[model samples]
Target: MAKRGSRRATATRQQRNGKQEPPLAGWRLWLKRTLVWGTGLAVLALLFLGVAVVFAERSLPSYATLQATQPGQTIVVRARDGSELIELGPSYGQWLDPDQIPQPMKDAMVSVEDRRFYSHFGVDPIGLARAVYVWMTGDRRLGATSTITQQLARNLFLNSNRSLDRKLREGVLAMALELKFSKQEILALYLNKVYFGGGAYGIESASRKFFSHPATHLSVSESAIIAGLVKAPSRYSPTADVDAAVRRANVVLSLMREQGRISASEAAVDPSAVKLKKDTNQNSVRYFTDWALPQLEVLLPDTTEPIEVWTTLDPGMQNAASNAIKANVPKGAQGALVSLDRDGAILAMVGGTDYVTSNYNRATEAMRQPGSAWKLFVYLAALEAGYTPDDRVKDVPVTIDGWSPRNSGGSFAGEMDVRSAFAYSKNTVAAQLGNEVGFGTVASMAKRFGITTPISTYPSMVLGSSEVRVIEMTRAFAEISAGGFTVEPYGIVKVTTTGGQVLYQHEDTRKAQLVPDYVAAGMTDLLQTTVATGTGRAAQIGRPVAGKTGTTSSNKDGWFLGFSSGITTGVWMGRDDAKPVSGLHGGSAPARAFSAYMKVAVKDRPVEQFKTDLKLPEWQMEPDEEHMYGDPGDYYYIDEQGNLVEPNKPDQAGQMPFPPDSEQGSAPGNGQQPQQQPTPAPPSNGRPGDNPQAASDDFLNRATGRGGGTTQRTEPRQSGPRSVTIQPTPQN
Candidate 1:
């Protein structure tokens, strides 16, 4: 009994100890877990507070030191005499105050680019969160998650390269901008800095370029168009893709309506009614500008300001030059025209008939064979080689070092004066002159005339077989018109800063005398005679005109280069494929067009005189006179004294024989009296000369030299004895 009691007591004590230990172990575990979790939560809270402080500090504005470099801006083009031609810009970032920005444009941009732009402080946390979510979902690409202030900050201080580091930098800059500027100021900066396509950077330039109106007057539709361009300028450019632009513009309008910036009715605005008023020469003058820009750079070597180039382009003249070509040239025919002043200032230049068809400016870019136009250089060579206008040269077939040149008509004139040879466009005579003057002399003259191409000292050079640009040719001819002084064509007049400080001015310093004043005058006289009586007769104007007509051998090219007292003009007409123009010759097509254009070009200008003191050599007949008078039997020869010569009498003939008019009856003194010669019966059988009385009347009408004067007969009567009386016989 005593042992059992002791065992029971021990078992109970052990049980009690086990129960207490279980409760203590459970309490210890609960306390440890509570302390650990509470400490971890406190640490996380401190970390969050630190991150917020850093973000808040970053949101404060920070100032940066800029070198104050003037923005790269538009260059204005002016004429030499200080007339505005055009303005060109890569970015239209014109600075304007925030108040100047139209309310409609502002609201439209906000609605389209960032709806919560004004409410956000540079960084849009909600927008960023959304953007992150969208990125995480892989449904949208990452882009700027910033407000207007942030965008302005990026534009002002950040590089354009897109990268994570750049994004971080942009965010830092944006926060700095927000701290520095108020929402209104930041919005204004963004408005002025944003690009609006069409070479327009700011709202002001965008307004003017698109609507031809000021930014202050921009309407909802206009604002929407501008707002749409922010996403993809090229894709929504009104000039580049009108349809896509209209669609995007409508999206902007819809956004405005959705954002309560505009009424639903306003959002229904017809996009079709929107018309983009673009500059007349949007990018069409890029080549001309390119050519002019280098020159401007040279002229204003020290200029940091934008340059203003003034050209003498009469818009009327330029339009006429362009339109005339478009209207007259064939569908595929490419042509160019260059009009310039005597001082080598290019007034109007038509690079191609249609700039939209092809941008290959035939005027300044093409270096094709000048053909007979090249003869002008050859003539310059001849004059330089001591040959005069009256020098005689054989137009008969000739060969020079196995190279024989044929006349244009394929028939030779046998022999002709130098002037007659040039006027008549006798190829054989030109070739002979080239040989006489030595091809090297001609090439030298061409070089002096500004022909930069390599010229061969061969017989073909006489025919302008070498290639040259229309600009170079026009420049050369302008030197002739300017009385032998070589001139460099200039477009820019002066360069100035936006603050009206003069930066650079084009200096006309370099000049060279290519020929003597008299020589230039003599050449002008020859060209004038060409307009009056030569192949260039079609280029004649009421005023004093001098010009040369050129027709390539294969009729593949036609050119007319001429000058008035104040201006020199060059015209070229040919197929782009170099195919021959049918029934087209320089004397007809190009000359006629040149004459037409000059009539208007010189209408108000005073007539100028060419220098005329150049010495000319005396005329001398060739040694063999037989070849000159070979065809003496065909017609009656007469002396300068008006005395009739016997048939086959070459020695007494002072001038070439003249064929008698059919209405003048048979031979004189052949038993035919003037009154009884059957009235000189005209040609019959439906021929042009069928009407004898009509022919006589026509002759009588033309007989009067001046206006409305009666025809007078001036025949000398013989007072000598043995005056032979001839009986008159009537024809049936």
Candidate 2:
């Protein structure tokens, strides 16, 4: 019976493909099946790994290319005078021989990053096992699986994006690198390629960036601190956070002790006591370089070569602009400044108080309400419609389709010349002018002036309700300085490869005359009157200056656009969130930045006066209006004696000239002298504030007194009466 059953089973395993099969029993049969499946999988795995390796090898550069490759390439930016303003890419310090590398630094790096670096071949199995242990235990911080050699391979051959495919590729490269180079050679290469943050690449750059010394001069504490940065460069950067860096360095010291790289006594050295290099570039010119970087791609579309950029930036003016913005921009508020020549060369641009803290380039990127600064377009449009600056415009209250706009002081000065009304930034007058000239004409004027931002035709649009960039505003003012010719702001003088091949040279691209000469003269007369005795009086520099002051009704955005010393400058100040800033007024801080920056920026330039067909007669608000407005930031206010009084002039009344009865009119500083300190005054320019965001769509309602949302109030920190402001609420 058993023989018959075996025969039946054997019959099932009969011959196939003309080959007879022999029957096996128990473990033998199971072993045969296992061998077949295992061999197939092994062949597939080998094929997959081979293909991955081949793909990785194809992207690898030749040895010469690898040797020549910088962890990052640098672009040297030179100012107009050919002096170095800043280096635009990763900072690479002097290359060192293996002997020049300090032993302590090598020890710190190996101890913290890869203790088994020399014993293992690139991929450390022990470290990977620990990673597996960490993954299972849900302890992320304990798993640092990358070996030093693996890091070198990734830095040399890959990008920063993390993925499983990249990891597998990195592992293959690491193993190949181990075979091609000795342990010492790999370590040296790793040190030279790793990023150490603070714009630094390589160990040598890190040593100098943090310690202000070369790697050869580094002490054990400094070495450990620099070594600690590789794990998380920016977070552990001494320049960014000294406390965090010191804490990380302490951890590295403990690692060194565990690895026996340092004695217990040596590990006791206090890293916190180690003096680090101060950031010498607190006034970073990165603002200029950042603006110029993308332009290089446009200028040289075909080259991967590093280049030298000769910029229009004047180091002196850049320093001045940076200092002015930093000193004048109040705490919690941000400011941006752009200075351009009449031909539109950007001499200096400060995008914010500190580039290290926030890199949002407000000068070129932020599109906030220009306040009365936009009136440059409005008045220009009026001029285009044949109204002279001498023409009278009503400064009294006006209503347009149920939208009633009032003057800043809430008391209009009846009738005034167009220049005076503009000088005072009269919302009613500007709105009236827009209504007469046609909103389409206003939009056309803005477009002609290089303001590419979308302009709405609402009645309130005349009062800078539309948003524009600081650079665009400066360029528009520059065109006015250029006698009504269009000007486009340019920063790159030329871009050249390091080998002296010129790639791009800037040319005067546009000379289009948008407005007639008569209009330019009229606008100049108005701008001069503004600086001489209007809202922009704070910008006066004892010379022929033309400027305008613009403060949104919400006191959220302030602007000063002006021309002087053959240079046109625009300044903007506000919180990024569009929330109301306390005491923010165009006549105050923005003008102060313009003044501070221009005073030094044009100090060496020849003084030039504005060419005007008519002289602007100085005008002041009526005594009733002045008494009612009573803002220290106003250009001129009337005294009880009915005389024009300068609020900032101590000689006018032996003290500040603000109204004693009003809340915002208190005399500045001990009531003995007019304060030169830029006071945060009433930013309200009397028009309903620029509707921020979705609020913009509701501007018609808010301006016409239909619907409104709640306003965000910042506690008053500036020395002034609390600002009374109104605007359509912010949706962001």
Candidate 3:
């Protein structure tokens, strides 16, 4: 026994040390490795799945939380000056109990939104499979099949942004909803809370908005229309398009018949029965509220209690912005304006000339080419890459990939300094800068400047082929105005519940610097020069101002973005259909509107000089011989050498004769007459729009902001800013 024990001990020691145990053959060795690796992989997969599950379910609200939320709560909005703007919400209609809801309404909703409402849990795997198949086959005419519970989940807790994780969370919430409430309760919740567009929410409000009645009196055809709206509220709202809404209702009716909820005869829609209400929500600040409301879903998704929103909009500035658009925008064309403070507060926003005629928020929605205003990004990129505003860049004509950008002047001048090129809005120099720095680098520069829109790296993109929203473009200039820090446009300042509970407050903190101080100063130099003696001269208001002008292809879109008096404003004028307006350039009506708006908007704000480091060449505004009969402020550039130049002038006898800020009023936008315009420039080559000039004497006189001032330079204001209902408190 002792001998056997010794032998066993020796074998164990050898196995540990690597000798006694014989190695397994090929199959055994392979099996051992497979088992070890398989176990490791399995552990890793489990860990990853656990993390994913936690991430997906992290933002899900509890069933108790959802139950505690108040229904039909009103959203009250107020402007910066403490005046109420509007009250909007589902509370506009009467809330109905489960039994109070019409049977046809419930049936129609179930038939069109979810066919298997009674059979499936919150999630319907069969429906999901069918949707997947439809998606793979590219046939989406048959809408998605989110169960009533699933729809409740999203409507209650989630926003409109779609993502894979959002879907997962939705599924989990749907299941939780099914576990917490009965199917009938879910249906009632959906029918009451869903948005039916046309500023209507809840079945009762939608019924009144479309058919001038309550939900209880809605017919089967009306029920079908309301059900179809769930798929696309704006597209099917009868108030928006009567014919489309009627057609969608017929489709919903057909589905109801297929589901055995209605007979074929009842499925047919009667166009005569669909009567759209002409009385619209004509709230003057509706554009601002509509834009700010969606942000609430993102900011406080955890709560459903109605809240009061404090926005950054200045009523005076808003009025001035609207009046400017009306005065400057030609008939039949649309215009938008966005004004921002240095901290990114949206001081004023005008989405269109008349929001009553068109509710579309063009200031925040329309994406159009920025034209020469896009040069800001190009020049900013170059400045950051160690190029200076004083550096020489080629402006001679050149083509790339069969595409060549032509200057608005129709010809490119020879080599010129960066500041001169940017001031003159030279297209060739911008294209060359884009190629030198790489188009990708230029795009990155645009992104850095707060342009969130997608930009293609094609050569033409250097010339502003990419579309960008007016608000974002204004935000980009605000960044530069903010002394090189990143700026993000924000409208809402604070939000509080009806019970005075604070839900959200905008935090004021310093943002990351997007560019060095030197680069931003260089950009400022270019912009100031543009407004001082370049294409953006019309935007000047006596005091030093910095701005850029943009005119897209065929004069389809005109823009003027400028900053002064610690305020940055962007103006866009274009046709809604993207069609050309005859002879519209950034310097024409758009700049005129900017001139008029800023003159009044900044009356109370302090005048701040933009920072610049580059030593600009001496230049002066000399009277032009050709435009001698034209309006004053026409001028030509004459260098110190006494030789006439394209865009530069010596500051000798030809110094610009602009009036001081005090001469007009004590500050910008002051309610007083503007001083005389700068000595005019001569017409070069005996052609119109071919001469370098300061702002016309008439435009400089009319440049005003948020106060009482004359805006009539070429066109007069037909009417003042639109009016709105000021609801001081939410109506219960």
Q: How well is each residue in 1-732 modelled by candidate 2, as lDDT tens digits?
A: 999999877766664344566679799989999999999999999798667666665766665566567866578888988888877577788877677899998999998899999899779988898789888898756565889988999788765445788788788888777766778778888887788875788888888878877789999888888899888875577775676778898899999999888999888547556887877574558767877866775676555457788989988888899999989987799999999987788899998887766656799999999878888987876664435565555566667757888778798786666778888888887776676555666776787677788888787888889999889888988988988777888888988888998988888884766655656888998999999999988897877899998999789998998998789999999999899989999999989988988899888888897887832211111223234323444332322212222334344445445433233345445655333444322222223333211112233233323343223222211221111222211211
Off by over 4 Å in 3: 1-70, 92-107, 118-122, 131-145, 152-201, 216-221, 231-273, 392-394, 615-732
lDDT scores for all predictions?
A: 0.65, 0.74, 0.74
State in Å the error of residue 168, model 1.
Answer: 29
Q: Candidate 1's residue-wise lDDT over 109-175, tens digit each?
A: 8998788877776678899998888888886687557677667655666645567887766776666
How many residue-pair clashes does candidate 2 contain? Answer: 0
Query: What's model 2's overall lDDT?
Result: 0.74
Q: In candidate 3, what are the lDDT values of residues 1-732, reduced to their tens digit?
A: 999999999998998998876779799999999999999999998687556545545655554565455454577898998788887766447767789999999999888888888889788989988878887798856546678888788878775556678777787777766665778778877887787776577798889888888899888999999989988775566765577788999999999998889888898889886666775666447778878877886787566567899999888888899999999997779999999988889988888887656667899998999998988988886665445676555567777557677887688677667789899998887876665555676777788677889988787887889999999999989888887787877899999998888799999865766665666888999999999989988898877789999999988999999999788999999999999998788998999999999998877777777788643211111123343333432333222211222222323766543333323322235644446534422111111222111122233233312232222122211222110111111111
Q: What is the lDDT of residue 163 in candidate 3?
A: 69
lDDT score at residue 512, model 3, on the 0-100 scale: 63
Per-residue error at 525 for model 3, in Å? 1.7
C-alpha RMSD (angstroms) for model 2:
18.6
Model 1 gets an lDDT of 0.65
Each prediction's RMSD to truth: 27.6, 18.6, 17.5
How much is 452 displaced in model 1, in angstroms?
0.8
Better of 1 and 3 by TM-score: 3
